[model samples]
Target: MDPMHRMEQLVTELNQHNYQYYTMDQPQISDKEYDLLYDELVTLEQESGMVLPDSPTQRVGGELLKGFTPHRHLSSLWSLDKAQNIEQLRNWNTRVLKLVNDYNTKNPDNPLPEPGYVIELKFDGLTLNLTYTNGELVQASTRGNGTVGEGILAQVRTIKSVPLKIPYTGGTIEVQGEGIMNLSVLNRYNETAAEPLKNARNAAAGALRNLNPKTTAERRLNAYFYNVGYSDDIQFANHQEMMDFLRENRFKVNPSITYFREFDDVMEQLAAIQESRGQLDYLIDGAVIKITDLRTREALGYTDKFPRWAVAYKFEAEETTTVLNSVVWNVGRTGKVTPLARVEPVELAGVTVQNCTLNNVGDIERKNLKFALGTRVFIRRSNDVIPEILGKVTEESDGEEIVFPEQCPACGFPLEQRGAHLFCNNKLACKPQTVARISHFASRDAMDIETFSEKTAIQLYDELNVREPADLYTLQFDDLVKLERFGEKKANNLIAALEQSKDRDLASFLYSLGIPNTGKSTTRMLADHYRDLHAIMNATAEELVELPDVGGIVAESIVTFFADPFTQAAIEKMLNLGVKAQAPEAPAAVVEDSFFSGKTVVLTGTLHQLTREEATQRLEALGAKVSGSVSKKTDLVIAGEKAGSKLTKAHDLGIPTIEDEDELVRLLNQQG
Candidate 1:
């Protein structure tokens, strides 16, 4: 096939899949299949020396520029005046109508017609202005400081959802839109990350501002174009018609947008969106209602900051004021100490909020938050979100200033300070630590203990003198019954779970050990090298350092953990309790000379016909080092459907890549 023909076919297929997975939430092709096609296109482009302007290969992320260059809009972009409620919205309409009536009286001969409103969901995201010349996407900029914005044309191109060329053939056009992160994608990203992101707004902002096009591509950021900023030769009678024209030309229009003949219709739509906010995949903080008639909008004119033709009905502030009664310290897994503020029960947003996070010591000091026996404070929650403390009391009182404890509240041991964090020194003796560790040990990724739960472990710990995880094996039915929540049946079930954990593979058992800086991936690496817990414990630091992916810090942490007498005792006890800690039979070896041999492979996105574990095992058999994330040393990334930011990084680094499982297989087979 000709390069142009092939390019067109590839783009169509890729765009179709993008719409399926991103917009429609239904993906037809497996990630691996999509990658196969993508890789072919990339290879063809390189071999033929033909780079199509709209090729997907052209969009890869790179480092952010030293700074953003400002670009002024041809037509001034304006903000919208805010209305919080129905009455406020009605008042705005009335005020606008009165102005229109006054302007008509001055003319006397021609009276303005009743204006229609264009109501659309006000997407909670960063606003972007896109300029297209002769149907080619030209300039993309952020709404920086209102007047001018940082130019992000390079970054914007990487976003697959942002069309490189508009569907229309010819026009000089400017469109207003929101660059947003879909809620589902945001949640999925958070779930896979070591530290989950705070919210969608921040994620979207971070993605858009990224200097690398590859990074933007991984984020799967989507755009919805709403308004025509400046256009010539295209005439629309109303705002609705303009939106229809944009949509017809393959521009993504906000699906929640509604045309209202009467103000009551606008109010109804707004109410519907508000009530169904949770059902929608993206966050909508409010609704934007505008005069639909283009002539009416022009007559309404502008304010200094906002367009007089439109009003944003902001969601009512879901915040309430309350008093801070006390602040308490809580310990978490990984041993980070956090402070929680206990405030008087106050209705905020839609729920009653009694507590808010104080984060770390820095937050407390910065807020200068004083929670004596009783202190006045304010709390705010919007859209069923977690309530936050807005501020604290203005007046000073006789109550003592709250101090962070120097010792673990649960174990009464002195704490260790590392950077900004304070941690309990009692690694095993701390009740919270013990419970958390045991729970982690029995998690599906760790020991795979089918029946053990945190609740059951806590019950055994507090009531039955089950001080350590090893003690779980000795638990009796009567001992469980002595606890408040557990009955005879539950006790037996827990014992069964303990028995099942004994047969888990060495890697999971090692992970279940809960050594500092040791996670599931690292645990697997150690197991693959040493074969058993006994071998790992007996291995010297030098021997441990030789393992793939085990760095100096990780090696040191492992050595420290094994050298500890308490940890040694715990392991001895666990062995005595009949917990098996040995690797299963290694998979049949693939050809040693395969490209995967000794090379680090990072897998992202959904794989077809192979589970993640299966793929990892296959790569390991070929002597490859399979890893969880992309780093400087990653040799190849096997990208699949909805492949993330790591895939983009791999491309930017010019790393060798395989698009699909079949291609991966073929490469290995070639080496064989």
Candidate 2:
């Protein structure tokens, strides 16, 4: 077979599997099988230089969205003409056949017979127009007026299912697709949301519009390319060919699409989509039917509102009813409060849901929900964790009205409202807050006290009057042995772990401080600036602002934490109790003299040559900052045996990979 044709076949196969894997979480091929095909496609693409849009190589996400910009689409993305029933669909088919018949009568050479129609699921999602410049995804936009849209390149970059770059086709092209929020994603998001989205479409739109690309990426949205909105170098003979073209380029086109010469076949396909809609990850409100022949569609051009060649067949709403029992409130680790609806256990989309989130007090009030416990509420579930109460059937109920509490359930701290969010004011004194802080302090990312657990912290709190991080260093073996289940060995282990934590890295020490707004990464940045703990403690908010990613709020948080009398006293007591704060290790050399200098290197898998701590220290000593994962900023990856996705991701970003610790040592020494 010709290389181009082979490439096309390979593209279709790989993209189908990608859709099954990324979007559907069901891979048709094994990892080895997929890798073999992928390697073959890469080789073929290098040889031919004509990569299809649907190639699986495109899904390596890299670009970071800064903000949405104004973009003028190459072609107008028209709204489809609508049809309600089989009778209306038949009428449209009749009109299309009549147009084809007339065109055949007028032109002698290209006389047309009855045209076939292409049918695909009309995904109920945000319309996104993706523009490619020589196969690289340059911009993604929302359909504003068909001609112009807001470019959502940043937000789109975070969507894992979409390809960042495809094999080069000759010129610019615009692939129109739908950005769909999975029903499951929306349901999960709503559990902690201040204002829950009504449905999948709204949720998708919200994610796309989000200014922070990181948040958008967290939403795990999927996209399906359905049409070629514009193309400068490529032209399709028909809609089916266009679908074929999209697949060849590695774009995720709808798998259920079909071409039917007869009107009855089209109806069957539509019915099949409707029947299996419940099983789909994405939401679809209708079926789209279009004249397969591109020339015929052109002749039957546009109406004022929608395309005359295509029609949308909308489905009836999938709604049902349930009972609202009681509402429960949950406090998160961050102390933010949210409300949940404890409903009568009912099955929805095959899962029995007993509770659904009411979001917040504001959400409940805005919706005018008076459906107290035992009220016959109109509940509807759409692939959600909990069914939503559509509205109340009755105006009144015998149950008491749900009200927001003034005090925290776990601790007697007064609840304070900051905009829509509610927080426990007594941060250090609160039980949940203390447990959360201590647990975070001893976490693997902080002091790395693996033997210490939250349950153990609570036990210590109950018996030993352990109040803060400083109190942890003051624990005696006699005190531990007095607690339930704590033997001599357990007590010794706890003490040993605490001793080990005393000499933790400067970054870890900073992170474990339990300072508000300071996380693992932020602590690392702070350590990079101030090598000594004393220097950092003395720094003002103005000085903190000079560091990378440190905003006014974060600066203030740092200054305020160190300035606090209680915090200062706690640190003094901890230092006296053998909790020594280690200073930052000296770098091997300055950036100009060292190969490893100012580089972000990731260490993965098991190393026989050097321990993880030894390797990290060696690299840091050479001015290289070691990170846990791969990103665009990663300079190199030192992989040992069984190195996982971090190594793969480094390769995808075109970063260098080194095996064993010898090469790393050689590079550092040679450069130095």
TM-score of each: 0.54, 0.52
Report the lDDT tens digits of candidate 2 across residue range 59-165. Answer: 44334556668899888889888898889988988888887778888997977656888888888889989988987788889999888899888777667667666
Report clash pairs, candidate 2. Answer: 52-249, 53-249, 53-250, 54-249, 54-250, 54-251, 55-249, 55-250, 65-154, 588-621
lDDT of 1 by residue, 1-672 (tens): 788788789977877776555443446798999999999888888888887776767777655577677888777778789987789899999988898898788877776778777788888878988888887888999987667888888878776667777677567888888988877687577545544444566678887887766667777787778888888667788887888778666567765677877888888888776765654566667888888878777777888888888999987544456877788888776677777888888765556788887666655544445444466765645445556554454534445577888988877889887765688877667888778877888888888777778886687677777777678778776767767766788767877888888998898889888888888898887887778787799888788788876888888999998998888998899888898888989767666877788798998888887877777887877888888877556788998775645665565345667777778667655654
Global CA lDDT computed for model 1:
0.76
Best model per TM-score: 1
Model 2 scores a C-alpha lDDT of 0.77
Residue 624 accuracy (lDDT) in model 1: 84
| Ten-residue region with minimum lDDT total, candidate 1 | 364-373
